[model samples]
Target: MIHVLFVCTGNTCRSPMAAALFNHWAEVMGMSSRVRAGSAGMAALGGEAASEHAVKAMARRGINLAHHRARPVEEAIPKADLVLCMGHGQAQLLRERYPRFAERIHPLMPYAWGLRTDVEDPYGGDLETYEAVAEKLEETVQSVLQKLENSRET
Candidate 1:
């Protein structure tokens, strides 16, 4: 199975949402058994739950966030076959901090769809911001799924 790790500044928001959304998508596409997905933060404040706005925003898309807990990137990095960051800066930081795994790290947008835009952090922002971030994440996740499929076929 391919292990995919999604990361951000804090696991309380973007990364968790990315994990949940991708997991849900994987299940729907019947690819969950072939791929293992999770999320973590570069400097995680562990044990924190996802923000209320983030929960609600994902709920609107039928993705649950109840099982998420903030975790450190180190916890997931070593095991990941692919480490996807929400932004280029995060990818740079991961590569600089963990040079051994640099080749496995990538910005989620460009890695998935060749789009270089970062997924904006919505922490402490309004629900609208959270929704916008989720929408971008969903689009990127779809692209990621397609990429994974093509790779598997090869």
Candidate 2:
């Protein structure tokens, strides 16, 4: 099994969106059995529900994060096979904070989406902004799952 943990600043926007989308993608690709996806944050407070915009954005994709509660990276680090951070800074922070897991930590956009950029947070952004972020997350998640699926063959 492959466990992917998506990380962001607060776990209320980007990471939650990415993780839910990743799970949807896995289900669509018939790879749900082999892939596990979740989200956390660098500075998140525990038990906070996903942002309303995040919930709405996911509803548009038929995925739900209405019940997703924020978790700190510590709770997620030990279980993740791959740690996909929303930006280079987040990845760098993880590398510094937990050097032992450095090898598995990576920037989500550049590595998964080939954007050479970051997935910006839409924490207090409008619905349109959240929708756009969701779209990008879906795109990246597809690529990530595809790469993981391919890797299993070797």
Candidate 3:
């Protein structure tokens, strides 16, 4: 199985959202048994649920993220085969702090085909911003799954 971990500043928002989307995609593609997905935070305020706006935004897409709690990076990194970060800064931070695993870390957008932009944080933003972030994340997740599928076929 391919273990993928998504990381962000706080696990409450972007990372959890990405993990959920990817997990949902994996199931839809009939690859759930081949892929494992999770999320973590670089500097997490643990145990907090996703932002209110984030929860509602995901709900619109039929994704329920209301119960996700923040987790620290150290909690998830060691076992992940691929560690995808939301932005360059998060990737850089991981590389600097854990150079041994740096090669396995990458920006989520780039890892997701066609997307080269960073996934912005929507910590305290309104529903509109959360929705935008969710849309971008869903696009990126599709691309990411494509890449994974391609690699598996090789």
Write candidate 2's Cα lDDT for 56-113 as tens digits. Answer: 9999888878889999999999999899999999999899999999999999988876
TM-score result, candidate 3? 0.95
lDDT of 2: 0.91
Off by over 4 Å in 3: 114-116
Top of the candidates by TM-score: 2
Per-residue lDDT over 32-119 for candidate 1, one digit per residue giving the tens place of the 0 to 100 score? 9998689999989888899898899999999889767899998899999999999999999999999999999999988987887988
The whole-model lDDT of each prediction reads 0.91, 0.91, 0.89
Model 1 reaches what TM-score against the true structure?
Answer: 0.96
Residue pairs clashing, model 2 = none
What TM-score does prediction 2 earn?
A: 0.97
Candidate 1, residue 77: Cα displacement in angstroms equals: 0.4
Report clashes for each candidate as comma-separated counts.
Answer: 0, 0, 0
Residue 72 error, candidate 2, Å: 0.6
What is candidate 1's CA lDDT for residue 42? 92
Better model by TM-score: candidate 1 vs candidate 2 = 2
lDDT of 1: 0.91
Which is better, 2 or 3, measured by TM-score?
A: 2
